[model samples]
Target: MSTQPPRLPPPAPEDAAARNMRLLVLLRWLAVGGQLATILIVHYGLDIRLPIAPMIVVLAALVMLNVMTWLGHPHWPVTNFQLFGTLACDVVALSVQLYLSGGASNPFVSLYLLQVVMGAVLLHAWSSWALVGLTSLALGLVAWLSPPLALPPWFATTLSPVYVIGLWCNFVLAAVLLVLFVTRIAANLRSRDAHLAAMRQRAAEEDHIVRMGLLASGAAHELGTPLSSISVLLGDWKGEAAIRADPRLAAEVDEMQAEVMRCKTIVSGILFAAGEVTGEAPERTTLRRFLGGIVAAWPGQVTFEDRLGEDRGIVADRALAQALTNLFDNAAEAGASAILLTAKLEETMLVLTVADDGSGFPAAVLAALGRPYNTSKDRRGAGLGLFLATNVLRTLGGTVQARNRPEGGAETILRLPLVSLALEGSR
Candidate 1:
């Protein structure tokens, strides 16, 4: 037997800001490319007189910032501070480009709102408000300081129709990119949140199981001494000459002894099942002998049938025997006169089935067979048997399933994959 603590579930993940930062970085590159194209098209194709050298310098600075950002991406998580700074830098860069071109008169001025909207969606309220302030300051500074861009040579003498067309293009581009990117990022955020929520729920369930296991272990320890004393008293009564003279009294004493032993068995089983104590070290034994021992110990008539061609040797322990005993006990308690205990080899797995000739399990009981405090019995503290049995098998990488038989009674199937059991035994 191996003593081990209850396994805790893995921790829930943090927010999905890292991927968001990567997306923002990629979008920045596209913005840069778009800015360069627009600059070239207006200056060369449209024959507009502009300060090309200064505009190129600002674009170069933006590229270098993006490169540094991309390089540092994998090193740190994207926090609120990082996102705020990134968006602030974007605002500043866009402002500078707008200033170099046409200040507040630039058609791309609405692009500022894109950053504001994204900040509201992806960042804290304070950070989003901070971005709004920074953009407002940038707009004010650009309006007050920068010179307006000149129109094309042909339209220099009149207000240009091309400027109106540029405004329409900027509106369309901003709307399309915002819709596409924001929708995708929102979906990613939703998925990340859903995963984290599931992890949290699983963690809660694991915690509940751990608490129950600890409580069961504590109860077992508390009951040990009292059970031992009762066993001693029963043994003394059995040995009494006067009591032994009466055959009926002797049989009753024998029954009491058996009941006491069952109590002791249950105490040890609980502790072992909880992994609080390693009751006994595993021993090498044949499947037949293992199954035979459990069947012999059962209080009711349990018929054992081995369908395997040949019994194979494996590591066996008290926990495995106790679990099988629990199944048998459950059948007997359910008014079963006889239980058919069968063992067989199915491919690389060992299959054990316990079928009873009692009334079948209720739908509710069958549905929640192995869950703690979920049982058909009215006895107080009676449900832990199947629960402990299920957990014990699970620790050995096996599974237990219960269902009602169509003809009558209930059937429990326990399967242990040979490969996993071998691996466990090796460990």
Candidate 2:
């Protein structure tokens, strides 16, 4: 099996409070602009006698506060308390404007509901209710204390249709703006949550891979000395006169030697995976030559077909070879007598297909092809062959897929982008 150092997932991103605060600041600017326009329309167009000087002072104070807020640590996370205080400031500003113009009789007096709705959507339940109470109290006090705004004679009448129409327009405008901002904000929150969840999953996967690597490395270290001793004894016996006299004894000794070498290779692979030792470095070779070399290493019968026409050079990585070897080993375990490997260029990608005339993977295994420990085999080994292959290929900007062949077998497809491989080599 290819021994790759465990892959660690990237770090989780910082919280979204800073971003949300920036967004709120922009929204507040919109609110300021809207209020300024409304004030101008009432003072000039309607020709009303109102305290423009005091009203302008209130607007200027709000604008200054917003400016300070913008400059103050834009990177600082906005907490619920901070948001609550900001909304409270807005409510106070609106109440002051209403008190000067027309108390609770102003059509824009309904704008208090905007702060209430925002509080409900953005703050904790208790905090939102607190804001509602505060705004309600402010509204009542304004109506009881401030003098009424001077308006056209037609609107002064209690039964005036113009007053009713103005209220209707305020209600519609408030409803539309509230729904629009709330929906957009809600979507932003959902997107942030989803991204965080995905990062958490990757972290879990990385942890599992790290634990597995530790176990493999420890086992390899413990077994290496004994396997080496066995090989030495086998070599000595093979060179003896008594063993040479008997063909059966010589054959058995040779088989033992081969098995010992296999064990050594396995231990080395594990050590390499632990990043404790470096194996053979990557070799520069054509795609056809690389595939041929790997297939040649297998003792079983394998049919190889290369249809790429011209030779395409690649850096041969030991891990890639080990990954493919693991796949072949799985195919052999599934009772495949002969395997077929075909390679071709699909656009700018190298597509290699490995097919075996064995019982195809069960439905369950096919569904979770590259997940670790998902296998039907009863063996000492974990079902990590496909998992390792998948990860290794993924690191090279490639993908591995498995399927059951209708012709009574299993097939694996590996697609690797040539450009990605070249880029990886350059790096």
Candidate 3:
């Protein structure tokens, strides 16, 4: 479906260096085999008198070039040196072969095109053009200066056309290989840049996690006293006889107490997670119940919807409830009154998405959303909320990705592997 050539695998630093070595060794053997077979077939079947000894010595030079190709990557200085050396050898070999086989009249003279093509494949554009010029001049010199050998009567008059054809082949092959290598180099640069960006994104996420933990721990400590006082006041108010007489007051008090308890529970959970201060905590919980609590606890008025597919779920530190609460709060602040949460299941894996019809991502927080220092909220948030969530998901062999929708709003998708699901349920 693509017009471009199939790319070689990404050459990341590592075993790739050794792989280059092995490849050069293999290429040397292949080139040697092809040359040896050609020489044997031409000598015996066609009786072409070539400079066999000089050709054998040139083959030795090719072997040395192979060793250097193994040591030098595409951009190394030694790579160009080997490329030039190989081109020189190719020209010398072609000249020697021409002198023996009747100069331009030789049946095999057209094959010199391969040398120029090989040079272009491995060299930069400027170097490739220089090599092409050298090739053409070499062939012309051989045709004019070399003494003509006595050939069979059938091929006597075709000498001029033969040399012209050889020159044309050399130039055409050079053009083709130049295009090939240039395209390969461009693709390599793009892939390397993408890999670098991913690494930087990860490092920023880690720094965010540490800062978020400290902030959550501090927030829990500060809220402890007020939550305790409210709990006692509500109990005393419930005991008053006037409150029992008024059903309306009793109901309102019950709702207020429920909300206050919810806030206390959320604060306590954050401390237990970030501060490691809980007595008993579950390692994992069912996705449905976990998410339902998150939506119910959000501080803003919003319609929340969910659709869990068959076998759809996730395994996390049960701390996922707090993580989702953080995300929901962000959506609420973005003026999203409605949000949708859904999960997809296919072949033992889960993909959960949280979507909101609010401004996709604030321009201010875009650059540092998952990082440790840039909080979307105007307050000093320390920006670790999403960072913590991503880590929790990663520990369970999952990932989190966020993207702004082309139409409007934003979505966060979490991909989870299910290999350890049964193991998680036990916790």
- Candidate 2 lDDT score relative to the true structure: 0.79
Compared with the true structure, what per-residue lDDT tens digits does model 3 show for residues 194-274? 999998877766666667678868878888889889988998999899999999999988988998898888787877667
Model 1: C-alpha RMSD to truth? 14.6
What is the C-alpha local distance difference test score of each model? 0.78, 0.79, 0.66
**Deviation in Å, model 3, residue 296 alpha carbon:** 3.7
Q: Using lDDT as the measure, which candidate wins?
A: 2
| Ranking according to TM-score, highest score first | 2, 3, 1
Per-residue lDDT of candidate 1, residues 130-202 (tens digit): 7766766676676667675778666554325576456545544554455456656867888999999977864
Clashes of 2: 0
Supply every candidate's count of residue pairs whose N, Cα or C atoms clash at under 3 angstroms: 0, 0, 1
Off by over 4 Å in 3: 1-201, 242-252, 275-277, 283-285, 299-316, 362-369, 372-377, 382-388, 420-427
What are the C-alpha RMSDs, in order, of all predicted structures?
Answer: 14.6, 13.8, 13.9
Off by over 4 Å in 1: 1-206, 274-283, 333-338, 357-370, 376-379, 382-386, 419-427
Candidate 3: 10-residue stretch with minimal lDDT:
309-318
Best by TM-score: 2
